[model samples]
Target: MNYKTTKILWKTFVWIVLIIGTIITLVPLFWMLSTALKSNAEVMQFDMVWWPEDPKWSNFVEAFTTLPFGEWTMNTIFITVFTIIGTLLSCTVVAYGFARFNVRGNKTLFIILLSTMMLPSTVTMIPQFVIFRELDWINTFYPLIVPSFFGNATFIFLLRQFFMTIPTELEDAAKMDGLGTMGILGRIILPMTLPALTTVAIFQFNGAWNDFMGPLIYLSDPDDFTLALGINFFKGENNQVQWNYLMSASVISMLPSLLIFFFGQKYFIQGINLSSGIKG
Candidate 1:
């Protein structure tokens, strides 16, 4: 084949693959939305229904108003916001130290930190529960929010990678201008690392927003339940599962994450690339 013809064929193949992948990914989401607008009768049928004959737009209103979804949503937002703040603050400071400061055993410590990521959370779950129980943190936001203030190994690693990419000359100039460590980090380092920080925040936000296990374990009060937990209860409240309402609630719960990801996609991709090895 001619070179130009071969290149065109390759591009066509890639586009075909991407289109197929997109359809596969979107199918489940489309199904979920389709089911949300369906009736129980339609949902139970052996024959698959791609779309409902009469779409129940009211399912969203009913699902949202039937439970304390508003309260749960607020609770989720509070936890997610706090979690992002704690993660950013703690991870930034820790990453800055590892990236900028020359300290004895810094490399060793960083390796040790990275190693902790390999340790499964299942291994520490019991110990963490016991500690939190001892502190009387159960059924409290403390259990959910407090841990994020301690640096997450994955986020620290990403931030540290991005931090190392920055030129040291900026720090040198800041020092000459009498900017302290915090000042340099705030004014010079953070502005440049916006992509990475946004990536971290988005990760934390999605994790916190969708978190089920943590809230399930730590929060006992119904009023304090997050969306995930609340959805579980929503299913349990009915003897026969109302698939329509369940899917509707789920669709509602996922909207914030969907919106955030769609809006921040550019920054998120950029952050991942820069942290992977690209210099700032």
Candidate 2:
């Protein structure tokens, strides 16, 4: 084929695939919304309603009133915000150190850090719980939010890779101007790595938002419960599950991450590409 004709054909194929993929991904979300609007009887009907026959918008209201949703939401937000801030500050600093400086035993320390990532969190769960209990941190937000301040190994590694790609000449120029390390990081390195920071913030927010197990184990009171933990309250001792309410709550819970991805999508893609060691 001629060059123009070949390019047109490739573009056509890409569009077709994207449209198909979009439909596939959106199907479940559409179903969730449909289900949320459905009444219990309509949901159980043998003949499925593609959309609600009489959409019960009150279900969302009922979902909130049935539990201490406001408190739960506040708790979740607190955790999410702190986790994002902590991960960004701590991970960026650690990654900068690893990428820019050569300290004695740095390699060995990095290897140990990476090794912790390989170890299953389940193995450390009990010991971690005991330590938290001793510190009187149970039933509080500490156990959930504090760990992020130390940084995540995987995110550190990702940020480090991106930092290493930055040209050293930029730092050299900054140094010649009498800029200290913190000044260079604050004025130059950080601005240049906005993509990576946004990416890490998004990931940390999602992780904190979706976390159920950690909250389940650490939080003993409903007042301290996060949104993920609050979802379990929709179940009964008799195993009668409130599927509609659960689905509605889940849909609502997913909005923040979706919004973050929607708005910061460009940075996210750039971060992924840069962190993968590709010179775009």
Candidate 3:
């Protein structure tokens, strides 16, 4: 084949692969939405339906009625918002200090922080639970929100990398204008690192929103349950599963994260690229 024709054929193959991959990724999401709109009979049928024959919009209403969805949603949102704020505040400050300071043992401290990420959470889970219980944090949101304010190793590492990419010239100029370390960070460095910060916020938000284990461990009251725990309970009742209602609740739970992503798609892409040191 001619070289031009060969190049075109290669591009076409790549495009085809990408399209297939996209479809594969999206199919499950579409299935979930479709199942949410189905009746119990439709959901249990031998053959699968891509779209519900008789769309049951009332599935959402029934799901909400069947569970303490309002309370769970409020609890989940509160925990998620606080955790995101804590993570952003703690991680960014620590990362900025690591990036800017040259004090003794700084490198070692940062190394130790990064090393903690390699240790599995299971190793610390029991000890952390004991500590929280001793401190009367169990059965409350404190255990979930408080520890995060101290900072996360992964988040610190991501922010630190992004902070390292910034020019020292800005900080120097800020100092020339009488800005102290904190002042420089606030006015000069942070504004310039919005993309990286937004990236960290997104990760923290998603983690808090979808957290199942932490809430399962720390929270006990049905009244205080988060959506993750509440949703799981929807299937565990009297050993019977309600597939249609379960799927409907799951779709409702996903809406906030989905909307956040769609609206912040541009900033999200920028943040990920910047954190990875990829320039477009």
Candidate 4:
């Protein structure tokens, strides 16, 4: 085959693979939406249906009525907000320090910090639980929110990487204008750091938003449950599950992350740009 024909064939194969992958990813989401709108009888039908004959918008309403979904929603929003705020405040400062204000042992300390990421959380879960128990904070939102205020390794690394891309001339310029570290960060650097900050906020928010294991471990009361655990309340005795309401709750759970990514697409793309460049 000629060179042009080979190129066309390769492009056709790539397009076909991408189309298949899209269909595979979309099928589950499509089925979930269909199931959320399905009546009990329709869901139990032997053959799968792509869409429901009767779309039950009221499944969402039924989900709310059956569970403390409203309460869970409020609780989740509260936790997610705090988680985002704490992560942004702590990570931004720590990252700025690492990137712009290096000190003695700073390099070693950062290496140790990055090394922590290689260890699985399961290794420390029990010890962490014990420490929290000693502090009398085991069954509270403290377990979820407090550690976040100290900054996450991944967020700090990501922010630091982005911060390094900024020109030091701006820092010197700001200093000449009599602005200190905080002044420069607040007035000049922080504004440009929006994309990185947004990326961190999105990750932390999504992590806290979808948190199930932590809440299950630390929350004793049903009232204190995050939405992930709260939604699981739909399961009852004999291991019977409420299909429609469960699917409805799952669908609802996806909205915040969806809305965030939708509106923040521009900033999200910007965040990726720093690391996305490839050198020849």
Model 4, TM vs. native = 0.95
Question: Residues 1-280, candidate 1, lDDT per residue (tens digit)?
Answer: 8999999999999999999999999999999999999988899989999999999989999998999999999999999999999999999999999998899999999999999999998899999999999999999999899999999999999999999899999999999999999999999999999999999999999999999999999999999999999988656654778889999999999999999999999999999999999645
Weakest 10 consecutive residues, lDDT, candidate 3?
233-242
lDDT at 15, model 2: 100
Task: Give lDDT tens digits, candidate 2, residues 1-280.
Answer: 8999999999999999999999999999999998988899887889978898689888888888899988999999999999999999999999999999998988998999999999899999999999999999998899998999999999999999999999999999999999999999999999999999999988888899999999999998889899999989998779988878888888888888899999999999999999998766
What are the per-residue Cα lDDT tens digits for candidate 4 across 131-189?
99999997788999988899899989988888888899999999999999999999998
Worst 10 residues of 2 by lDDT: 241-250
Q: What's each prediction's TM-score?
A: 0.97, 0.92, 0.96, 0.95
Superior candidate under TM-score, 2 versus 3: 3
lDDT leader: 1
Evaluation by lDDT, superior candidate among 3 and 4: 3
Q: How far is candidate 2 from the true structure (C-alpha RMSD, Å)?
A: 2.1
Residues 120-148 of candidate 3: C-alpha lDDT, one tens digit per residue: 99999999999999999989999989988
Descending-TM-score candidate ranking: 1, 3, 4, 2
Candidate numbers sorted by lDDT from highest down: 1, 2, 3, 4
- Who wins the TM-score comparison? 1
Clash list (residue pairs), candidate 3 = none
